[model samples]
Target: MTEPTTHRTEVVVVGGGQAGLATSWHLVRDGVDHVVLEAHTLGHEWADTRWDNFTLVTPNWHCRLPGYEYDGPDPDGFMTRDEVVAWLAGYAPTFGPPVREHTRVTSLTERAEGGFRVEATGPDGPEVWEAGSVVVATGGYHVPIVPSWAPALDPSITQLHSADYRNAAQLPEGGVLVVGSGQSGAQIAEDLHLEGRTVHLALGDAPRVARFHRGRDCMTWLAEMGLYDTGVAQYPGGLAAREKTNHYVTGRDGGRDIDLRAFAAEGMRLYGMLEGGAGTELTFLPTLTAALDGADDVYRSICRDIDRYIDAQGIEAPPAAPYTAVWEPDTDPTSLDLAAAGISTVVWAIGYRPDYRWVGAGVFDGTGRPTHSRGVTALPGLYFLGLPWLHTWGSGRFLGIAADAEHVTGVITGRKGGARTEPAADLARRRSPGEIASDVALAG
Candidate 1:
């Protein structure tokens, strides 16, 4: 019998998403021999998981993936889900990322003698890889979560996690109940509302941010304000802030504020956080008003920050009025009768969590979170990247990938601490027409 093949490399970067690719970008510059292993094709999540009408909440400019910043026709504009996949797909070929597509890393264990062993199953079947260093860039969003009572709902009512949801037409012809008001929940709810379908939202305590504030995008303003540069150590809530639900906002239809109150005024129903459910009935808390008000508080706070910045900088900006609630719930409904309301679908956008047991128990804390400073774990040469606050606010996002990747690569390359931007001079390098044409044939 043929033995499972074993290959050796300097580094093994698991996950071929933007995070891994970003790491690969730096490794290539430093001339490191590393391979990125991905369970599926690169950017498959954006192509498969996101709703059909999905677009970026952050504008195109924030897609600064190490070498490839968004230089497409739309810099300020939000790219559609397909465009995002294309942009990511285009990235690997330009720099020729040594990525093994369709390769699933089953386990990563440390060798007793100063290296790591990676076991994976590829198209050629099972194989093992040995590397001096291992970077887990798979990120923290692995398992999609729904409430415990989801399975008990009536079989007639279609239930889909935000990860599995594609479009409104895919569901049964009836009203939709979107549980959770985070980015995905809010955007998906808006998508359904635009389709003229009845959307009953179960709002969570996640804050909302202004899409376009004053003369620029809120992200743009925040970036200038050094919000993205704030590291985990300096973050207000410290490490505790990492688990916070992201502020919900949208960039759909050229970008605008997501006001659940406005949505409510337009006939969409709003409920509080989901508590439990049985059959066709779902129970919620009496925090609908609190959630909306909390969201607005964040929105106004962000706008005020932008306003202060504009005033401080003595920059002229457009005038805007204070946001007032467009509508309010006459009664905070603690229960939603799906069958009675004609709701045939429940889109749960609660959130996701990663299971890191496969990486072994030594590196994780009691809470199952990686115990690392920046991306470096207690175990030598075993590191994590692309997780929220891995280094800074930008660490989990495109805006910070380069710096984080550079920092991690610098350590692997024996340069020690600090990220360098000098390598980015090679970022704008273009691919030949033939090279670009032959790379990554994707489907709509």
Candidate 2:
């Protein structure tokens, strides 16, 4: 075969999502030459993967991508998947980087000459790039993780992962059992229930938080209290925190609050964590009360922070109403037979695990998790970004990616020993008149 098309760059940033784009912004600002290799068009996940009416769990104000922040009228509101995708698509051209869309990196090998050799396939066919450094900015949630017990279920019952689920009409005619009570699972269960389909949600230990507490957005209080600043080491759960699911909250109902108990109140069934399946029968752990208790604890924890913030800021605001509804699980029907309940569909929203198979070995741990200090991998010149809890709890989120990217860039450039510096001028140019006002709020 003919030799692969060869090219070279100072740095090769892989994946074109928010993480990669944020990294590119820092690199470009520092005057580094690089190429962004994307498997598909920019923000394809937000465009194609999410359902039609899917709204973000986080509000629009949290949509801070390095130089850009949400400046729409509803800054406190949540953005739909399409709106986010459109914004990202438009944001890509702002910096004018050399981005090669539709280029999928199939393999990444270290070169003896002290760099990386990236092999990818693009529209022009096989291509190769030699770079001094590589940044894998692929955000989390690449693969849908179905439990080991999934295959044991009877094949007659249809199954789909949350990634594949689009709308209620797509599923078969029957009750829907949605596994995992995280944000996605809870929202989907609510959607199905609203569509007149019977929905059953597998209870998880995800915490609950109100959309607005005490006349202030919950996120604002959390951010001010440095909640997102919590790192993996400092996390109360330690390693377990890395795998913990997000709180059960939704942006639907005009940005109103939603939680697992709210779903139960809306006439959906709630069950404990799925244990296993025997033919058409499914067994669940009897931890429903524990899950509800855990959520209550989280809510209380947040409320405590809100109370503290109010005291510190000296701003008079209405006290939040005490949240009292709790789901009382029925002790009788723990195990349910799918056929008997008329449940023909199962949606697995358990979570996701990253696949670094294409990258060289030894950079990841025995469990295939990357061992990195903030985004710096063990291997020199190989880095990681956008991983959950990589540097902090918000590292994987849009609002936090910029700081992480800036830190990684400092390490790469040896500037101020990996410390972050505010790029006010760069950010100001990217903001609209409306966005400038929001940016001011972000600074405060």
Candidate 3:
């Protein structure tokens, strides 16, 4: 027997994180009917994050949702992973939006009548929902990228990605090995070391930001100088540059800073990029900036903006010290055999990319990222929000998503949830040369 299909609301929001909740908040404010579908319990993914010491790098002041402020002890203080999860869970109830928990959206496609068909699986079995609009807020950081060589390591040595890591208790008694030098990697390395685990961090070409300067968060400096405020039109090359710089810094609340070079001074080993083969030695460069010159132009522009802002404000804030800290990869190329170093565990924290297999054609570029002006996708009534580096440098970050969500909501409601015609020149300019070439080749 065929189960009857169900229909409700004007829009459907996938994922229940900060982004999804924020979208729902906007929809309610606009008096638009919408339902949020979460695969697990509210904030379950964040609650299940492996890092015990994980906290928002951005302070509380900037972490507001659409209608609710992040009202906690320290407005400028960093929030732990638990605190973040709890806050997101509280948002929907406070705003009176219906968020359906444990509902996993299996697939989404356009309906025959020009709406959306969302197929989902829940405790009640397979269900089909029809809506006029869809918001793909599934988030960008859900999946972990484990290198293929990772499985070659001996099974006896416990290996887990940063996402699966919780506390030092989950690791073996001997010690631990942390791979990737991104923000998560660096923070976890410091946490394990503080927990009394003899830590060895595998360094990559990731950049670093100072924890604080002149008694203010580095992010505040970036915002005050209008660095994060620039849009793609004003700075076409800015997004690519920000991706390379790795400007995130770990906070003191998470753990004491374990400088990659200073790790060796504290009797911890630092290894650079790992070559393939059974026992390849790790190599290092003096500093990562040589590989990061492409990003320096953007940083210089930001610094210039800061200088101009200071002069215009006539504020007597003391200038920050000259940036002398050299964040370099490990130079001593010794093969610290995992078995020999008593390292029984490994954690990979490289980064994340979107997987849009379920999304049909015409909505995404070759990269699988949705094609959108701000949050509106290419297809009519299909929109996306809360993607990493979606528009600005901080667009997908905690502090930046709310503005994007509000803007998207305004577009949806103002036009009665219909697609807007793109100006020909604007459309042509948005496509990259490579994309145009691909289209031409396909036509030929």
Every model's Cα RMSD, please? 6.3, 4.2, 10.7
lDDT of 2 by residue, 1-444 (tens): 757899999999998889999999888888999999999987788877898779987767677876677778876667888888877777777887678999999999999989999999999999999999999988766778998778888999898899999999998899999998788887888888889899988877788787767755577557656677667888787767777777777777556566667678778888888888867999888888788878888887888878877788785566557778766656624688899989999999887777889987488888678888898988999999988888777788876788889888888888774435333223323335454344334323
Q: Which of the two candidates, 2 or 3, achieves a greater lDDT against the reference?
A: 2
- Alpha-carbon TM-score of each model against the true structure: 0.93, 0.91, 0.84
Assess the local accuracy of residue 90 in candidate 2 as a C-alpha lDDT between 0 and 100: 73
lDDT of 3 at 130: 90
The C-alpha lDDT values of all candidates are 0.83, 0.80, 0.67
lDDT of 1 at 398: 80
lDDT of 3 by residue, 1-444 (tens): 558368667999998877888888888877898899989976677788747778877756566666676767565567888788777777778887787888888889888888899888877777787988889888766568787776677777787888888888977888787878777887888778778789887667765554444334455556655556567546766546435536536654632223555555676667665453243222344333342332234344545555566678784444654443344444445356777777778787777667878766478767666777777776888888887666666577666677778777777777354322222223223434453343233222
- How many clashes (backbone atoms < 3 Å, residues ≥3 apart in a chain or on different chains) does model 3 have? 2
lDDT per residue for candidate 1 within 65-118, as digits (tens), equals 776778886566789898888888898888999989999999999898879999
- List residue ranges in candidate 3 displaced over 4 A: 1-4, 236-245, 254-258, 277-308, 323-334, 415-444
Which residue pairs show collisions in model 2?
A: none
Q: Which ten residues in a row have the lowest lDDT in candidate 2?
A: 422-431
- Which pairs in model 3 have colliding backbones? 50-165, 50-166
